[model samples]
Target: MYPRVILKETLYKKSQQKRRTSPCNYKERIFMLNTQDLTYFEHRPRKRPTQKGCIELSHIKCVEIVRSDAPIPCDYKYPFQIAHDSYYLYVFAPDNDCRLKWVRALKEATQCNNLFMKYHPNFWGEGKWRCCHQTDKLATGCSEYYPNGAKPLPPTPDPKCRFLDLEERIVVALRNFHPEEDTDLPLHKDEEYVVVDSSEPNWWTVRDKNGNVGSVPCIYVAEKISNDIEKFEWYNKDMTRTEAEELLMRENKDGGFMVRDSRHAGVYTVSIFTRASCIYRSDGEKYPLVKHYQIKETEGENIKYYLAEKYVFSSIPELIRYHQHNSAGLITRLRHCVSRNVQNSSRIKELSSEKWEIHPDELILSEELGSGQFGLVWKGYWHEQQVAVKTVREGFMSEEEFKEEAHIMMKLSHTKLVQLYGVVTQRSPMYLVFEFMENGCLTDFLRDKKGCLSQEVLQGMCLDVSEGMAYLESSNFIHRDLAARNCLVSNDHVVKISDFGMTRFVLDDQYTSSYGTKFPVRWSSPEVIRFGKYSSKSDVWSFGVFMWEVYSEGRVPYDNRSNSEVVEALNAKLRLLLRPRLCPQSVYDLMQWSWKEKPEDRPSFALLLHKLACLHQDP
Candidate 1:
């Protein structure tokens, strides 16, 4: 009351002090700013400190840091990041396409040394790093690291792959393809001057259009004739249709690599790496989770390289021999893939055991022909004719067992069957020679190049197998193993049923033995596995699984379960779920009919063939 009566100017001072001290009242006096202002402050470029020196700030992390800022074209790109010791290098491009172009440039410039140069403990390989670097430019002149081009130090060797070092092992975006060349090389063979069109030799007049002479040595004009064999090119494994076409166009425009042969016209070879797990099929669907693929590359008749996705073996013969004994050592097989210093046949021949010799005179052996449970296979020759020779370990199976296997194979002769050419059954080891199939096994062909084969192609495989089965049935033979890996393919789409090691001949259509080697129960009829008796009808049951294997791109049937569990489930009359959806309904219906537990209930192979033939005609 006394203060009110006094009503002094001190009261106004007190109120003003209170407003300044109160948080809510203080905030009311200032105008509010939006997040937009903060964003501007964050991205507004300020000069980097000068002391940083010659180092370009990577735009890779910058966009992420200032994400709210206005969009830049670089945000969509994949940055190349290389870390060496304490320093980290980053390269950001406008987009994936630009990134790929940059990568290509680096690859061309580095000469297979760019990846090693970019990483810590710099290292390189002769032709090893082609697929690893996105770009070929080396970071040079920096005192902090990689100073004076003193030849960057070699990488620490990986204990697993002794021949390849840490930085030397590279992961790249593209695969390389080099086809076999004919013995002859023409004048226009080089990339610069590929002959686009050539008419028949002008022998009409003594004086030609350019005043060519009549009597010249065969060598004088022979170079002008095109002699190179046609080639097929694979560019990038992950390429989209549009990207593939663009690459083709680029090849055409640049005129860097040209194929004069009509078969190789307008093509680019895509080199795939070892870890490459996906393949884009022509059907617009990408195949995912692939484990491996068998690859073959030949140059003239002198050199060949067997490439398993990324792993390259120096010679097919060595890989085959190694693959035979140790199936588990997949990567070890590639340790020998080194740069071609010279053409040495005697040295390679010396690498193998005295019992096994890889014929250097035959170029086909240079190419990686195929692989199997027994060992590495090669396209070889005997008596000057092409053949596939499978080399095995020294003490693999007893001679008696080898003879038994040979006897089983020698008796069979069917167009749909891979014929046994010869056998090297010496006391020291065992080897089998068979007719070479240019296209490789059906399992590999489908895995590498996937699609619904043409109706004609499908019919040919089906009919071929049917014909083979017909022979097996008439001879009272049972092909206990009838999967894709055991089947070979000819260039003409003909199928040959192979791998008859487990084959047995039955006196009748049933078995009385209480126990024997357990059948391939996954493919065997339920009655055969559960009841332990088999016949042609049991083979018909296996044919159903074979059909499923073909349709599903050789995916393991009932992939999640064990072979024993599959037998147990089938014995219990529980239906094994077909996982892949690509199988046709007709095939599914046929499998259900053939897989019935009662063997007698199954349809005949001839009947099944007729039904499958009908699907081909309609589908």
Candidate 2:
């Protein structure tokens, strides 16, 4: 029987990338998606289309937007990716509607097959995965993926963003508001005004085109974004290097870029992506480099800004405009502008803003996930997804402590870390909402799946925790309590570090009378055991114990010893965790390295991360 046609269109496809090569260029192809298979053919005008490839629907696992800011080389700007077997096929559509139509059709057609639970939201470029920076092509996805393509509850709407009033420096009065007092500005509908000061929560200081200035209600004016620097999609005032790469890679456009403020005051930085770089990673993939050029200015009467130094322009905008059309000594020309909205930056902002104040009514607590020293954890459903709800026990933490930890959690975001969904602060007992983990704690997971799991999986679990710790170390933060029980396992078996905020809470059994604070004796480093010292190295020592738990299939460190006894063993530097049964020699060696008596001698979590990434189970 002939294949039933579902959708067919000519599109731009990213040619397949081979190992150690620069990013492949885009080529026009005629794509046809049908019941049995999806195929693409080389399209040439006035000639028969030559079939290029075919993918069985069963082998297809993921179909989603290639959220990227890299400039598209093709006329069709909107891009999507297909993950089939071991390959990823990226294609572009004329517009967002066309892109979504194809994505939805493909998803509906392949609903019955095995699909990924998590997928990288950005493209794999240079030598690493853009979103997570994982080098392996088959690395576990960093973002949750939905088979039904469900989106998170739309972040509570911002009243300030209504009718295009979103971040506009200049706005038009929506309707007439006559001045009631001399201080108030009289507004006329559709009359233009520049917002001079918006520091007042509800009011703004504005200057009319005629230079008349006074206070006005923020609600009376709406943004007219057709002109202005903030109006340009490329301008991102708060972007950092990491944020810039995330934005550009999410766009998946080769020349995607943004103009952000430099670290220095009064200077702008142009951050752009180039598919190929001069350097290559250990994986032999050409490093996909995100290049940031500080817009430099000449010391002259007619000041000019330049990125290449040789290519100077009259103004910053003129320089940007010139570089858009010319590579001119840089890696790539700035081809497409990706705004922060595409980055969902506002949602990131909201995590720390008033929007973080989740209504107590929205949460529906069901089965208990676990009970801990801090409080009870319940498996709950919010906005159609399972979540873990942690209730802060009364007297467990002070209002000051809770606020401090909440602030820390809000700042931490990583694939290996359990995400803090939101917090409930209005009620008696404070609550923290987190992303749900299906397999519970790593301690329990290793216990249950002990013999069934391979050495690779065990190592991966360690890698996950190490990655999280590495991030903590880099952030100048410390996870004082790092242990198997403090990590959670997702449904796909990806491990994530959790309960990081619980280090402040006192665990009854883990407390030492001399220390005046509670820290798990078995996992505690020598310094922590003696001086109650907690640093990233101390966390690394704890990580050694955690690794021992993983390879030993959840066997407790110092299982036979008491807290006092374990402290003595650590204090003397005579005893350390023994190699778990069947643990790789290299891994065990690294574990020992992490447990060095001197904190300075212990390898940093960042170094440990590199060591773990380099290891493989003996063939």
Candidate 3:
């Protein structure tokens, strides 16, 4: 049966032929969506329209939004794709609403058909399929399919329940609520509601005591518990301010205590005891003094807490708990009391072993090499040998976690991988000693020597990184953040992969990040960017971007786009532009091979290393 015509509009169609040669050219066309097919007509302004193309409803496998990164000349507001049998028809709409209307209509039209089973949310057209290895402009090698190369049956929808058996939660409005939308429920202060559906984390559908049934923001209400003890702990303070202070003083034997900031309401300042001279005293003589630890409030008022303006915490309890585990800042003095008790802990023992541990005194930190979220990297001397010392920021990481990371780094060693020498755990900021690369980071080196660098040098760098990645892949490790910035170069121009902070040892080669973990978007694979699912193949995707950076002389990938834009562009199946005049097409082909829509379709680092080696030999 043919799909009904729901909408028709005059739009510009990006010519497939023109896109390959002159990407800016767009022909005016009239797009019509009917029950049976999507038909496009050539728009001759003064004359009658003539049908140019039609995509049958039966052949349409998928319809999706395209967030293109490609340098298309026309500023088409909303670009989308319709994939059918190995080929994708890229179309652009005048607005986002128009695109959404078309996409929704198309999805609804195919909902009852088998074609709907092959639908993908983000799948868009890539130049060609890696499976068929076609480079020809007009070649359509393989049909559009999912990662597995088979069209699976559509998922069974969840059974509809007439009435949910979930508990009816009664809550009172904690504050005045204003509804942003017609479907949103507005509540007066102290108004009550019985929660019908608390499925959504932030918004809950509630039936008010007044019989109103609408969604209300979860933060606007509080649970209506009968007993004071069952109420929110923040509101359950029975002790007087004096009594609270007394208890806090007693608990904080080492002199760190939290008190409400006199200057700011709803803000608390943590004062930690330090031997440093008080602000009032300029005398060199040091005495016990309490100093306020700078706190940074993030996003929502009660949600996030940052210690010393660095370590992030979800709440006050989380912040206090972290400090209790790993005393730092002015609280470092308390380490004598804390570390002495936990010194024999299994984790500390694992990191403190004589073979892997180095005395803090031996690590003479020199000039700072670089700084990151974790801490700073310094060019230093360890046992008279030059080393790169990466220090974990005082409160950013706990002692136990830092030690575990050190243990993992020590286990990994390869010629093309930076070697972790030992860890210095005697101080507040723990030091991880590693083999110092005389040339510093690869990105800086490449950028500094940009036009002066030879193709052979760039090719060698790619091979070096691929070899390092291959070793990690074989060892069942996924380097989640593999880029030129994370790779270091030696005095002899040997490039070795570094930055193992995001690396994980996985038995299955796939590692999913915990919710809220931030990752660089430009170098990430589509799977990694969308789902945070990382594997060696994902690393290969990043390696492709890294190779682009190398060839471009350290130019940032998607330099013109924001992280969110880069993520959107990747979802659209757009990739870094190839410098055909500067680099060989063969090398660019390898980059494309790594950027296949399917992660499995991407080449392994081992295969990539072999190919790079072959390229090196040919050069």
Q: Rate the local accuracy (lDDT) of all candidates.
A: 0.44, 0.73, 0.66
Q: Estimate, for each residue in 253-298, the C-alpha lDDT of model 3 and write its tens digit.
A: 3333443343354555555444333334467554454545555578
Runs of candidate 1 exceeding 4 Å displacement: 1-371, 452-456, 511-518, 576-582
lDDT comparing candidate 2 with the true structure: 0.73
Q: RMSD of candidate 3 to the true fold? A: 17.5
Residue 568, candidate 3: Cα error in Å is: 1.9
Q: Which ten residues in a row have the lowest lDDT in candidate 1?
A: 6-15
Reference-based TM-score of each model: 0.40, 0.47, 0.46
Q: Residue-wise lDDT of candidate 2 within 273-312, one digit each (tens)?
A: 7674546889886666788888888996967678877676
Cα miss at 548, model 1 (Å)? 0.8
Best by lDDT: 2
lDDT (Cα) of model 1: 0.44
Cα displacement (angstroms), candidate 2, residue 477, comes to 1.1
Model 3 bad stretches (over 4 Å): 1-347
Prediction-by-prediction clash tally: 16, 13, 7
Question: Top TM-score: which candidate number?
Answer: 2
- lDDT-better candidate, 2 vs 3: 2
Alpha-carbon shift of residue 602 in model 2 (angstroms): 1.2
